[model samples]
Target: MDLDALVARRRLGWERLRVLSRQRHLDGAQADELLDGYQRVATDLSTVRSAAPDPSLVTHLSGLLAGARLRSAGTRTFSWDMVGRFFVEDFPAALYRLRWWWILTALANVVVGLALGVWLYHHPVVENTLLSSVEVQQLVQTDFESYYSEHAASSFATLVWINNAWVAAQCIVFGVLGLPVIYVLWQNISNVAVIGSLMHQHGRADVFWGMLSPHGLLELTAIFVAAGVGLRLFWSWVAPGPRTRLSSLAHEGRTAAGVSLGLVVVLLISGLIEAFVTPSPLPTWARVGIGVLALLLFLVYVFTLGRSAVRRGITGDVDESLEAHVAPTAG
Candidate 1:
């Protein structure tokens, strides 16, 4: 446990490990020597720290071993460029590549909602069963509009944003189940359809569309995108095609995760519109136009920027250097 003796015994091995760690590239012989020296130095450091406990010696060996570890396994650091590329390329590319899936999801949901609305409109008995005549009348006349303005705009926006984001997150996170995503979508569609039907019946159809279209355009689209991604995540394993099931799932799941991140912003915009525009005294056309404009901007970002990003080989994944490698083939 003598400090001097301990330093003398391990200092040479530790120096060798340090030198090897500093090298940018190692020849075959050097690489083998590096590994050998690394192992020896690591053991020496452990023995010295336990027996000698000299702060200076322990510190030097510890630093040497840390450097060797880094050299042996490699390391990475986050950079601003990575953040910039993610927003400009990775996020949009994922959305664009998965465009068809989401488009189909949007269409299906709209159709289901419309069908449900029509059916409910035709069946007064169904409405009566769900809600009393008086309650239905209140919903049609005042409750529907009052709901938007019931709270102050800022707090309402925050609440709506958090609620919508949670729903979208659930869709993506639980998307592997497949059925959950559909169930969520069905629940949403049913709510809208029931309210829509009641409004139409009460001659408040204009009010219904006006209240919804301002925020619903983008809000629903974001939800549809999340649902599509979730569905795709489920489908990746079911029909991975040429790729191994795990590989396909990982790839698609990574892309789907990007949609989740992107949708947070999308849903926020929708929430803002719903709070500020929907209940504002602004003309319905102007408010709806703002929503349409927001949706259009998102679409352009996806189709235009996304297509370009994909062509450039961005897949909303970590850069290739960070990606896992396949083992070399014997052939």
Candidate 2:
């Protein structure tokens, strides 16, 4: 009604609005509440005074509304580096904590081999372990040519690749949990011991070269790399340097896990070639060549490739993300 009362109301309104308006962006609820409050106040002011509303105040309010709209427009965008930071910070640390399983597994690795070896040494007639009757039957009944002919050559090859990868993945992943690591070591020990005993008995030490030379190089190296990681895990807890067992396991497990997964992938690739290709009835020279190729693949992955991948991942958020995702996939 009075000029003084009118100005005071306008001043109070502007003051509160200013407090909320300071932000560059306004949320929907806040902006709506503010706009409604100002609209009512403006109506009252227009009645009390002939003067128009201040343009500067209006511009400030408008700017906040515009900024809020801008914020909403780009809602779907996200930082690519987010996942990189997670794997680098979270997954590796998880692997580190899991190292103890690796450590325990390494110790038990030799048990199966020795058991198989000793048994084969005494029982000259036994050609392989018949621990499971079903396994023996499956091996005996398997008709390679019939199975191979049933699927298209390429289809069979692809299927074998996938199966090998799955098996390798299972071995490497479960090994970290310690179950596969023990089982693998047991299998290897039993199997290798038999081979050793057979070689010794038959005095055909060189036969190992022919029987194992081809895909064996890659397959065996992959197993060892996995075992090495397992051993590293064991040593972490056993020695633990100065730290507690848990603390040691946490740190080493991380380093060991990347290596373990890499090993699995390597084994998968090797197994695929051995199963689906490698000429099935590979000659001695071809087997040796494949074995050499497997050795080279192992060397490249362990020393040059795996190191670089992990390094790029941990170096920075961006590089690690790229390395973790794009590089391994492309390779």
The number of the candidate with the highest TM-score is 1
What's model 2's lDDT at 44? 48
lDDT of 1 by residue, 1-331 (tens): 5767766776677777888999999888988888898777667666666665567766676677667767777776789997687789999998888889899999999999999899999997998999998899889999999999999999999999999999898889889989999999999999999999999998999899999999999999999999999999999999999989998888887788777887888899999999999999998899889889989999998989999999988878666644443322222
Candidate 2 residue lDDT tens string, 175-208: 4455565565566666566556755655554544
Candidate 2 positional error at 325, Å: 24
CA deviation > 4 Å runs, candidate 1: 1-80
**What TM-score, to 2 decimals, does candidate 2 have?**
0.46
TM-score of each: 0.78, 0.46
Off by over 4 Å in 2: 1-122, 125-180, 192-211, 242-247, 280-282, 304-331
What count of clashes does model 1 give?
0
Best-fitting candidate, scored by lDDT: 1
Q: Which window of 10 residues has the lowest lDDT sum in candidate 2? A: 322-331
